[model samples]
Target: MVPEERDGRDHGEERERPRRARRPAPESKRPAPANRRAPAETRRPATTARSAARSAARQLRDLTGHDPESVTSVERQRDGGWLIGVEVLETHRIPDSTDILAEYRVEVDDDGELVSYRRARRYYRGRSEERT
Candidate 1:
């Protein structure tokens, strides 16, 4: 067998191999630095009652498949969330007064995301309630 010569060194010589450069580990494999904290919800707060009402109504419509006709009431809850009353037309009739309407009580978080909702009441459009 013939001897192999590399860099003027015989095959029998003990030469150190050149080290290969290491690449940075992928982002997922690296541990997070101690100074970095997990991200918190950074959504903007719904400041005005009108905006909160709109948000609640939109969210209710998306969930229930009924478009809200009006915002009946808006109240701030003790937990900093909002309680919104929305009116939706459930059924149409020849006479507008005979149309069926439903009131939904929708609760939304401070960030305008709906957390819960329910049909609070239902009645005909022309029906009048006595407030005593």
Candidate 2:
């Protein structure tokens, strides 16, 4: 009588088939996460005209190192941006009327970045322009 096989495989096949060895994937040099920019760089979209005006005023103060008094006007541009008018306090005086104030036209992009700014007019706090 033939002897019973100890392994599960048939008598014709090898007892144990060897497994193919796998090579590890090589590591590639990638930029570190610290080099990546913050989400703030993506920027927040400008929502309302009032909010844009406020943002312009705050940005102007930071750029010019002056105190912003009030927002004079806010106009929407064709590019979905905003042309904001900001009134900044240039100098203070005992008589409030004599205080120096300036009007600046600030262009803010849709991404809330200050594209450009220029001083449109300057006058005393009490002075009012004659509308034509």
Candidate 3:
């Protein structure tokens, strides 16, 4: 029994079996050169807040037939867009009230497209209110 168990093979000998050779690393290929310059239209600078505001006002006037009174504020978003607040002196023909002021929120993308618009808030023409 002892002789049978002592056959020449040991755990260490089994562990010494040769490992398979590793494959060589692949070579990186160079990228192909671009065919031609990008179109000139693609090189224009992104639209800014001032430009967007001007364009939005123009569009609003064209669509609503009223010239917005003032641009209260313009904010640039992280995604290269703008939020413009315009104050328009709109007259509400309610029975007792004469004129009412309203604010419109205009959104424009970097390409100067009007993405969205809505009325943010409204207040009396002569009253002052805290900004949210």
Candidate 4:
């Protein structure tokens, strides 16, 4: 303690000064869990348009006994089913380049089960559908 000068601070008042509050410890910087699931709001359901399209393509190939050429469209129906349009080579000609093509509308359940299907249109491999 400094020698109290005649400036007159009573030594007893120095001991009465307010004590400072202790601060909390800082938060830990540990890494987050590796297996943490995505927030529910940000996650999408397992059944998606692409999967539905694949299911339709598989069903069409299996039913037609030929590999499907392409998936043209996929639509969700009001009945909770899916509607997919597929193109397939229906016939082979002497020249491999000349094949008959058919378009089918396939219906499937949400679980990817085949509900029904029908051929919507037919055309040659070299020609496109004529819009009327």
TM-scores, one per candidate: 0.62, 0.61, 0.55, 0.60
Local error of candidate 3 at residue 27 (angstroms): 34
Whose lDDT is greatest here? 1
Query: TM-score of predicted model 1?
Result: 0.62
| Tens digits of per-residue lDDT for model 1, 39-90 | 5444234456778899999898888888799999999886878999999988
lDDT of 4 by residue, 54-95 (tens): 998897788879679899898888666789998888887867
| Cα lDDT of model 3 by residue, 6-90, tens digit | 5666656546568999776555343334875545455344886779889777776666665688898898876778888887666
Segments in model 4 whose C-alpha atoms lie over 4 Å from true places: 1-46, 94-97, 130-132
* RMSD after CA superposition, every candidate: 12.1, 15.4, 14.6, 15.2
Quickly count the clashes in candidate 2. Answer: 0
By TM-score, how accurate is candidate 2?
0.61
Q: Which order, best to worst by TM-score? A: 1, 2, 4, 3
lDDT of 3: 0.72
Q: Quantify all predictions' global Cα lDDT against the true fold.
A: 0.83, 0.81, 0.72, 0.78
Candidate 1 off by > 4 Å: 1-46, 130-132
- Clash totals for all candidate models: 0, 0, 0, 0
Q: Indicate whether candidate 1 or candidate 2 has the larger lDDT.
A: 1
